[model samples]
Target: MHRGREAPICTRMSHPLVFDRALLRARQARALALGPEPFLLERATEDLSERLLTVKRRFETAVDLGTPTDLLSRALAGHPGIGTLMRAAPLAAGLAASERTIVADEEALPFANGSLDLVVSALALQMVNDLPGAFAQVRRALKPDGLFLAALIGGGSLAELREAFAIAESETTGGVSPRVAPFADVRDMGGLLQRAGFALPVTDVDRVVVRYGSPFTLMNELRRMGAGNVLAERRRVPLRRATLLRAAEIYAERFSDADGRVRATFEIVWLSGWVPHESQQKPLRPGSAKMRLADALGTTEKPAGETP
Candidate 1:
């Protein structure tokens, strides 16, 4: 791996910090220690690996970025097309001593410019405060035509929990505090990729709905996944018992099914882009086509002022 000076952390944005990254890291470490459920990370790894299979090119150097578990790295291990797949975690606790792992922050990657052939992240990057800046750094770190593919928790995730909490808090305490981390929307992702100077950017969402016995069960799973509310503006006071009970009741009333199980939605937004290269496809310049649209379609041409 090509090592460079640690990239400066880009935390400030036009808006205030949306996440408490330090707290998030600590929670993630604790979750790991507690043997958090691996279902979500496993699903993301499978999807990302399948997506990589569709591309025929071999990557001489690649990275797994900050996935909480080693599932992604292990899945890619011994893949014929991948030469040296390194795993990077935000903290040391997430690293495996037996594997080629590095402690690197998503916001401040330590890679040299144009040094990587590919970068894949699964179920990470959503907590980043300066997401655009992180994307820009990833773009800068990739060789021309190198690919960046990631799956992160999207905005549609936990809609039920968010709504239930809001209504319950309002009804019980007269106000609602930030209880969930804000996620990235799929709609703005393409523009973010373009802004980061990546070419052929593609973004899509995979919505997964998991059913649980109750809202409390789902909340416990989230904490075990290290994805509990870590908002910088989150309420420091513990949630009132009345609010918690009310939220559970509201969740059951609104989101429960025939079997009396409640649903939790997780939207995994997949993003992919490439560093620009001349060999890649390019859009035709305006008025540069040899065949006119009318000729190609075998239809009569109509002027702007004339109706067809």
Candidate 2:
């Protein structure tokens, strides 16, 4: 909780120190080697594009930070409100087609202060080591009333896989090692948006369930998407074949449906907000409203500090 403003927001705070930037980059490059299946990226892009279409706010210039695939570039081009759009990738530098695609890090955004009308990130911020710093940078990069929209893997994602890995490791190696990266919950993420100074922030989780033949198949997809565990506390040694096989068994036994296909969860958390501006509506302070709840609701109401 925070105080002292019309809308409460936290100051500079803790970084997500668990993620490894170098490993994340390496995995991202590795994923690209499989030539872009892009199922998740496409879904994220569609959701983002749909949300943008509903908003009345017209952005003249926009930036897609930490673009995982080329889908974002096309998504931006379809929206008529944006005049220009830039794609910033993490691994590739200065790849130009029609729009400029420059390599950029999410932890350290390259945009000048108040330089953008809109900043959109997809499937990118989850790997950022300093998420607070990254959000703060996004807030700073926006002009007054500039909008920010992003979608990332959320806390509810991949629960079955994480549990199976832990149980298998504990049973096989007599120890538990981190096999999945933790994600922030939507409620907590809403606070983070405000912590980064976003006004009227909104956060929600969209849970997606996909069925696979086995956990190993799921792992292959995650690897191909460059979304595998890159946690600093992850096991340094390779996973034993016996342990991997056991984990697969556990996953199938626990998370599989009657049809024998195992379920995998991908909870996409969408965070939306805008820079503070005079034009936006704000909540009135306590006791400052012209009308009372009694009048509005047509009922007898007792004032606070009075017990009736």
Candidate 3:
């Protein structure tokens, strides 16, 4: 049995690493759904759900994990991907004309065991402290041969930001600041799926290079995109002006391109797997062709029921 380290979450199981609230908050506030919540995190989550609906319609029966936004549900209702209308305009009109249902929450999915045909989540699983537990639950929620697909930021994400912070802190304070928590490695993620009883687990990575005039611009974009760091013991105060300057200088020295814009690398790890099923199981049949025990070893082939 694969026993993961106990995380500090106050529920059924804790994750090995502390989950970052900032990152969770950012995810929550995203535009998964529509509307302006005073909280940015809330809006982000809404946005996330909206985007997920686009993927959800692909499955025979799909369930989204996390909060859903009204705007997203509204958008989903009108999305032509569901085959609701022929023309885009007609689809938009039909969507605008219908009410939609959006379910929110991942930890406690609202589905019976082995009921889901497919499950897809985007950029959300890492935030869950008890990833193994979550994976187990997901496995149980899927039908035999059902598929699970997810996109998440991995350890290689934000390399430039991490490097800049590391260099600046080392030069200024002789210590590295803990502003961000590292993401899961590709190998680790694949193992997680397998350990959770998922079959044929596969993990692939996609590298994205984003350009920014300055580090601050990049940071601001990250914040807007709800992709900010969210380690549990992250620094509460803003970085000092001098420290920020040094960080920027370090970033330029190490990561700047000839075009004078800084490059930030994001590693998006795509994971996929299937739930195992008894119907797919195979057993060794009687009278099946078998390798001769002695002939392969240069000894005389044994007759039936005879020792070599």
Candidate 4:
């Protein structure tokens, strides 16, 4: 939790985790209805494609867990390495489904254990109310040595915009409301992967700095990306025009570069893990080494717990 920031009431154990699942579905529906452009999803899928290209192995079957947009599906559709590609939507929002698309909740996947060869998600997992539950479902759906890869917004994403909103609300309304969702830290995500039984877990980040004319453009892109404020504890009323104006001003004042455009940081956290199999390499056990490091490096080594 951030200092001077109280946990949202909906997050309390006595109450439910305040993510409005329906609101999330509605936002995606609205975004698809309003704009056909998919900037954020395209960029994220591009990164995912790079990772996919690195694998020398092939998959007989693969699943794209969340279908916020068709970017990922299009990328994988023609790949010769993957024999069958399927798409699943978290919500049944009347997203037209082909024979390949299905409506299944990530938290409660219907796939049988050890069924899939690969599972990949891009820019979708952050909004799930129960990440661990979702990950467990993914693990169960994968065959032994099956791979899981995903990329989502990290906790550091949109820091400038978050600060701008908080400061604007505090100055205009004398209090702040949740306008943005809290993203999971990378370390926490790695731990969750291990807890869900994913082996050889790997986590890294790709930080992107996008310059916008002002904060308004940033907010506009977020809507198109289906990344809206769906927090159950978010303010119910519409934001005051005065607050919006103040926020833009503060954003420009603090985050603008010499070019006069304000910058928004997008920290994309990438996760990779695989199901354990005997074919996979294992780390050597302690005291099982065949050669000493000092002998290899030609340097005298000091024993542990002793001064150099």
Compute each candidate's TM-score over C-alphas: 0.95, 0.90, 0.68, 0.90
Higher-lDDT candidate among 2 and 3? 2
Give candidate 4's TM-score. Answer: 0.90
- Best model per lDDT: 1
- What lDDT tens digits, residue by residue, belong to model 1 across residues 25-86? 98898888878888998999999888999999999999999888788998999887799999
Model 4 bad stretches (over 4 Å): 1-16, 91-94, 301-308
Worst 10 residues of 4 by lDDT: 6-15
lDDT, candidate 2, equals: 0.83
Question: Which parts of model 3 are misplaced by more than 4 Å?
Answer: 1-11, 26-59, 67-103, 279-308
Error of 3 at 127 (Å): 1.7
Write model 3 residue lDDT over 1-308, tens digit each, in one string: 01233322323664466766545654546522322332322343344445445543344455434422233233334344333211111121112333222333455544557656666565566666777887887787677877777766788888788888888888887777676667888889889999989987878877778788988888766655555566777677777787789998899888888989999887767788788877555566866848755756878765689865
Tell me the spans in candidate 1 whose CA falls farther than 4 Å from its real position. Answer: 1-15
Q: Between the candidate structures 2 and 3, which one is better when assessed by TM-score? A: 2
| Cα lDDT tens digits for candidate 4, 80-127 | 678898888754333466888878766567576778899999888887
lDDT score at residue 86, model 2, on the 0-100 scale: 82
Question: By TM-score, who's the top model here?
Answer: 1
